[model samples]
Target chain A: MNTLFVKAPAITLRFVLLLLISTVAMVADHRYRVLEMPRGWLLTVMQPIQFVADWPAQRWHGWTEVVAARSHLLQENKALLEINQQLATEHQQFAKLQAENRRLNELLQSIATSSLPTRYRLARIVQVSLDPHTLQVQINLGSQADVFLGQPVISSAGVFGQVVHLSRYSAQVLLITDSSHALPVIDQRSGQRAIARGDGPSGLLRLPFLAAHADIREGDLLLSSGLGKVFPAGYPVATVRSVSTPVGEKFAEVVAVPVADPGKVQEVLLLWPDRAVQTIEEPVTDDLVDDQADDGDHE
Target chain B: MNDVANWRDGWLILTTLLAALIIDSMVLPQFLGSFRPDVLAVIVIYWSLMAPQRVGVGVAWVAGLLVDVSSSGLIGLHAMVLSMQAYITLMLYQQIRMLPRFQQTLFVLILMVLGKLLAMAVLGMTGRLPTIEFWFSLPASVVFWPLIYALVQRWRKRALLPS
Candidate 1:
């Protein structure tokens, strides 16, 4: 036991050394963007362990999905078919409207061309944070593909989150449902606008600053007003679940549910629109010149 | 070296950790998730209490680091809190062993809460404090403590039985 005392200090020293090493790693990581290489290396080494860690849960989820009652599956299938039919009809109308909008845009382009460079790519969700407190998701795309920091992330439903950290082959998305995340949104129906913030795993969103008499109601859809320019206009954000106006409180307490179901989404599209069309005269391809020559010959 | 070949004991601990990680990640029943037990924490605490010579602050630190990496948070935060918890548990092992099962569980439950609170405090100071989910998970951990204690105890007893 007396000898154990001497070994104890040695163990503590070693432990402190490990702590110092990790702290230095973290600090260096934060201080310089150049540290990204080592961080990527660490993530690559850790990827296998992460896969092992997630295997059981993912397998169980797969099993449950398989064992679900046939009747329930049929019911879900029917519901999906109905929803698909409705969407198909809406999509046709949307296509026509889009064509008209494109024509109008072309006419406007004759006058001026706005040159805001934006681009996007599709990525898959590789993992989600287990701790409900931190609503974050990891995507498989990273700096290798030019995914910059602070890029807005969205889903089919609406704005999901923004890219906070980037690595070589992966990036961490800060979900809008995260406590630290907030977005500017406006009610699509009433045109009243307010800031929407996450209320944590209760899966609720709150619009904290609305006048007591604001014409908002349950089921009102909130959309991105594009005021911040981070989010594109008219993306569905949330639906008002409840509105509370307590006497003497200046702001009405508005609770909303996010349009995107964070748990189930597998893939997301990252949009990066072209800023300008740079004309580069490549040595004209033989095939292109031949086609043009053929056209001239026919004329 | 022969004792290290105790597959039954090693496998049980591995399975328990796997299950806990799964439950922590997945969308389980609302009540269960809300009061979800800290499986890894309980396992580390139990091992440190029962076999202080084998499991120590280092093992706890590694486990906590894994949890931190698995979750999206500051890297060292969980590792630091877990080492602190293991240290306290090791110091109090003798007194804990003497207590009744229920009393021991309660003592450990307090330790788990302390660990969680400490982690939250570290996160808060770092400006990474989580929202309401942080507060909700603490009480939920306490509520699930008894079942976790019983499950670990049963496994320990089963492993100790000479085959």
Candidate 2:
């Protein structure tokens, strides 16, 4: 008779009801995205708190950078500037080559028009998820910034991921290294395209579908093939790490390491595909009908 | 005086929960970002035990929802776990609060494990099974409970002191 056992079974009933509602909400949210509007509004409400939560750490980080050795910082800064200039020069050359490709394809009456640079917006990562399987980060830019679902996200180093969830004030970017993420990529050296998927704990992408005799080899660069129309074409995705084909196996096992430095990146650039000039990423296997017609006309 | 105590305890609960969420969501990411303590769940369990009348099922539900939203996970996922934690505390508050601090920590350890299991179930139902990193967090949450409990206890005592 020491304990006071007050009659408050109503809490249990409320718990059950809340549980049922939440479970149903999870199913509904996952299957139909029925709660997007509400979730977006909630995120807008929560953004300030997130900022406050992130403030101390971010400020501490800022102070450390400010207080760091000037000599070391200067050396790193100079090297980065040099790399930036080199990349800018190489990018100009790529643009010129693309222009020439468009002109030549136009003269040949081919439908292949070079894909231009995708529209982009910048977003700083506000918070990162602690779950290993769901390697996601919330960015400050969202629907208010015209950040939409399925838009590809990239850092200066390489492709980071794609936007999976969009809120009014912020959005979640699912990293390419997440187990569920896969992208169609082509080996730059061999021109062999394969699907690369994140290997859960390994942190490297697995190309499980390449044929036994696929031209993939060690150290080949893999670029996004842009097959899914989600990630833009001609961006560096990952570099081949190892290729293993068991003697009796029908398919070759390949793995690649992503180019982005996941540890240090704080901001991601979101690229939205231009709906007007959607370029296909297929191999040019169509017949040269215009050449035949031109030859006949000359004859 | 009783009402004032309850109100002070409620404010303490709110601040502690907010701080827990901040630590749980931020400051935990390493290179791959896993195996961090479930600070938010542990705080919910602690507060629900310490002040069940104040931090009831409704408060727990909202706290869980906050974690869900902060992590940008599927909404309502943490809400379910939180409500269960609060409900259990409300039902057994009289018995549990009377136990020693060490026993209470053990109880919290079990609750955190169950919370982890429930989270795994929800995740499995929704998507992929969490890696070993997520499983490793259960014990880490146990290790964290004492420190969090001490800090929270001091905060609560200070808040309840005569002004």
Candidate 3:
């Protein structure tokens, strides 16, 4: 007790020193962007802790699958086969349409839509962010798996998010529904482009910049405009939930719910859009390029 | 003999801190995200009061940094906030230790609320405002304090005493 009293001054000194260090670190991280390398290294060191935390849930899920009744598995398999057949037929039509579109673009002499094909890799959510202020999730894929910053991630249903941080074995994704996230979206029905900004904890998006008389309506589908180039064009992003044009207001109060639910997403796909076409001096043959695109789509 | 006791104390505290870090990073159901208690804060508060010599502001700051890295957040946010909490706990540990259990829990609730507000202030400075559910952890922390306090006490008793 007496020693505790004597150490009061020491505690003050330690607190001041630590606080100063923390301020410097925060400024460096948030403003300067110089601490990314060290942050990545630290994430690598902390991987084991996160892995242990994720293990129980993963094992329980696996255990439940193993013990699940045979009838249930059979039913699920049958339904999945039906869905697979439907997708295969749809994909065949899509391939033919894509070729026709490419021929039309060539005749019109327009820049080919994303000169290179996009590749996707599968990943699973290993951890959800602890901070309630941010909506981010950690995926099992990382730099070791060639995951890079700003790479787009999507679920089977729609656009999910983009990778923001990378470690050796894991990466953190900034979900589209995060408050700080804004995406360029176009209404599929009206072809009107608007910015969809996340509404934070409400898990909704707000189009605050659109004029009151803009051509948006409730139930309209929003797709990625590809204007940002971060996400590919034509991916479903959200569906407009409500549109309210307040009297005498410059902007309409529009809200939307994300098509992809972060809560139910067990797996996500990371996308890689090939962007290095300008430097090539030799002209690549079209059939060869189409073959490559087909291979990329197989993933 | 003093060296051996000090080493044991370090081992005990480090193990508990590691557990807190794991639980803090574990995935939970979406509805429980707002209600999840600040397990590291509670552990740091408990240890800084009971074993002030072993767990001080330095340890608290490092714990906070680990949290920031694991959460992939702005690096020093938690470090600064948790250091402030540990500092207050250190400065007032003697008085807090002497209070009744009910009063101690009340004091903890106040401390947690203040810590939450401080974090919000920092985030607000960065131009991102958290939702109202950010404060829900304060009540959850209050509910879990007695359990954490008793658990840490048992470990302290088992590990700190000379056999």
Candidate 4:
């Protein structure tokens, strides 16, 4: 009885202390956002460590960039040159049609919305997740640029992801290929509505519950439906790769490959639309009209 | 002489523990991060095994608190787990001390995994499991146990021996 009494007090005290601390922490974390300030401070303190951790990968990337032979660069340059030439020709025609469309829109009393001045902020990819389970990338864009939560990010090819968390000088993006990520997408060919969800590791997107008889076919381009309003409409989301169905299934399992070169692109553009532009010039309706006029003018 | 050796031992252990905390939080890739060997856990466990008198549940609690604060996880989560871990390690110190180094490492590994799994489960129940990367860091931590033991043991021996 004496020995038990001696040990019990110590154990009870320790247990009580732990219980008190846990209750305080849990309550504080749940009740107030006061912890976020300190958490952010900790992140800032840990930034140096993040930089050092990234050094190896950055160095490896640098080495690869340097070791590419002149011949390969020349070949790439030549191919780009030809592509640029074709694009330049297309651009000239597009500009002419655009000018004519603007004139017709003015005549039709269409509201002219000034284009939002998009500023390009270059960020280096510091960390990339190789895990097939979660597709996320951390970039070096801090909060200094006003990159807020839920900002849409895109590579030159297409929409990449969105800024989920932003530190002072770093942000974590939830890429389009993560299982938890879903984007409202439309079939370019049939205008069928469906949601595109990321299927991790395979780097593919699954458009689930697509009606078995849905007019979706392989090679059909998918664009942002913008139902969520997070992403601006008409951006290329993915290209339909396959459409399949099991016997008696109501929905065809539609798979797509994202248009963005998720592996290669280091830099991405953050779309920050001015509220004034969004309110005035609905780009989707304007662009559709311009496309129709251009086809008519060409014929 | 024993006191001096012990003092040096304390300093060495403290420094290594701090380094492990910083490295575990900082340098490790988030993909391999969850299993990033529980550097702080290993350090605390090692110190508890080596010098139970110097390190105890309080030390574990404080160290765990630091880990919790730095981990971006719920506050006190690591602190509670770590304190419990230390207490458990302290309770089993005699048995752990007698085991071969490899077996000791395996025991430590199991404890580390338990801590991680426990933390994750708690977080999950709270609806705050941040990322899947959290679990991936375990294997890396397990793999690092032997190396950590060898290095720390060498350092301990060097400091304890006459200079």
Candidate with maximal DockQ: 3
The 0-to-1 C-alpha lDDT of every candidate, in the order given, reads 0.67, 0.75, 0.81, 0.69
Provide backbone clash counts, one per model. Answer: 9, 0, 0, 8
User: Which lDDT value does model 3 have at A212?
Assistant: 85
Per-prediction TM-score: 0.65, 0.86, 0.87, 0.72
Off by over 4 Å in 4: A1-39, A80-89, A93-117, A128-133, A276-299, B1-41, B48-84, B98-103, B119-143, B159-163
Q: Point out the worst 10-residue segment of candidate 3 chain B by lDDT.
A: B154-163
Q: Identify the candidate with maximal TM-score.
A: 3
Worst 10 residues of 2 chain A by lDDT: A290-299
Candidate 2 lDDT over B35-146, as tens digits, reads 6777788888887777665677888888888777777777887898888877877788788888998898888877777777888898877557776767777777888888
Candidate 4 yields a Cα-based lDDT of: 0.69
Candidate 4 residues A1-299, lDDT tens each? 11211243474477568857776876575444245455555555556656765677778778987999999989999999999999998888876776787888889887643333355566777753222224667778766766655677888888798765456877767788876577889888999989898886678989988889999999999998766556766789999999999998998999999999777887888777554244644432122111232221100
Model 2: lDDT of residue B127: 53
Score candidate 1 by lDDT. Answer: 0.67
- lDDT of model 1 at position B81: 75
Compute the lDDT of residue B93 as modeled in candidate 3: 91
Q: Any runs in candidate 3 off by more than 4 Å, and if so which?
A: A1-6, A276-299, B98-103, B160-163
Q: Report the candidate with higher TM-score, 2 versus 3.
A: 3
Clashing pairs in 4: A142-A169, B33-B137, B34-B134, B34-B137, B35-B137, B35-B138, B36-B137, B37-B141
List-wise, what DockQ does each model earn? Answer: 0.20, 0.52, 0.66, 0.28
- CAPRI band of model 2? medium
Residue A217 of model 1, lDDT score: 95
Clash pairs of candidate 1?
A117-A275, A118-A272, A118-A273, A119-A271, A119-A272, A119-A273, A120-A270, A120-A271, A120-A272
lDDT by residue for model 1 (A188-290), tens: 8888989887776567788887889998999999987766545556778999999999988998999999988887788886754342123213211111111
